[model samples]
Target: MKLETTHASADVASEVVFEAKGLKKEYDDGRVHALRGVNFRITQGEFVVILGPSGCGKTTLLQMLGALAEPSAGILHYRGKSLADLADPASYRAREIGIIFQAFHLLPTFTAVENVQMPMFETDRPAAERTERAVELLKLVALGHRLDHFPSKLSGGEKQRVAIARSLANGPTVLLADEPTGNLDSENSKKILELIIRLRREQNMTLVLVTHDLNIARMATRTIEMKDGLIVADQQVPQTAA
Candidate 1:
């Protein structure tokens, strides 16, 4: 199945959310190269999937996009401003980017609603407002009835839904998901994918998802194939009826 996209072509110059030029990430005294002079631009409202085998630097690239790690060399920009020049990179990450991981990293002791409210603690929002927003997000993810349930009491799919709700707590513009469905069964994977697509459609959020599965790659508005720390292929996904 193909994903529905707003743009007729990837070349559409609406707005650039992210741009990387000669992006490189090295580790262990420059002995390990996670990204090698990678360069690409992700436009606002685009769903771009990064595909490759293990150790191909897809995750590293995602980390850079999420601002979880800094590049060793080259330039990384957000909204035409250099990431390194940001006054507070952490604030940018917390406010602008939402990240989902394969493990559904929910706190075992916290209830679903509490977990969803965790990100808001970083801001100065009132406690009551935080609770209200958390509940709204949980409802959006179809977990309103499970709001009081702990992570241990929820099913895998429910846990993932909680994670998804938590990722939106700060109202991020970009969502970065790494192997979001890798731990779920096929049916659950489909449910999560559908939820993501729906959220993107509703919010016009930019998405960068990393996965080894071709089926998941096919659901993106654009597919970017990475290999040996470099981008090998970048193409637009064909449009499909909503």
Candidate 2:
């Protein structure tokens, strides 16, 4: 199973980061299917949008990619290695994959900076280094002034910004975002999208974002549309020039 390799810099960024074959996820003793025999390859630095309506299995597929959930039947490989082979999925998640949910799952007790540092503890980085890095990330997302603010104190947009910073704490190679703008207002949603795009460019990150917004899907270089637990369409779209 040899994959095409490329030269250094931008060329090497074309290598596959994730590959799936016959991927399926089921529930209730196979009575409910979330993902149905999906197959795809996501390359490094690719911006992929999983577009579909509610209950279309986009989130389920994303969970599998992040190793938060296992596939019921089929192989899910990350960088050519099966996710099932990973001895510690937690480590894989903390150090390799970053996930952002729409809920802005920030701990109510922690400040913005503290929430960002939370992921680094799992990677066992030095305490001081974690705090320093967290501060840098928050500042990058324009939340430096709000470092001491807790989730309850921050606005919807600000909280989501903190979540984005927290997701990048470990410098993950890939970022999976599930309906990140669902809870945001139009103005905030545009801001969040811009921030994400900027970070993606600066980091040269591989991003898989799940959204039902057709306009949002147009921003992706490629889009995979899921329906009734299956990928009904997958095709190229105009890439965002930003």
Residue pairs that clash (backbone atoms under 3 angstroms), model 2? none
For each candidate in the order shown, give its overall lDDT on alpha carbons: 0.88, 0.87
Supply the TM-score for candidate 2: 0.94
Q: For each candidate, C-alpha RMSD in Å?
A: 4.5, 4.5
Writing each residue's lDDT as its tens digit, candidate 2 over 1-242 gives 11111223375387899999999999999999998899999998888999998998999999999998999999999988999789999989988878899999999999999999998888667999888888888889998899999899999999999999988888877889999999999999999998887787667788899998887887887899999999999998765433
Model 2 superposed RMSD (Cα): 4.5
**What lDDT tens digits, residue by residue, belong to model 1 across residues 172-210?**
878999999999999999999999878976777898999
Off by over 4 Å in 1: 1-13
How much is the lDDT of residue 95 in candidate 2? 83
Instruction: List candidate 2 segments past 4 Å from native.
Output: 1-12, 240-242
Instruction: List TM-score per model, in order.
Output: 0.93, 0.94
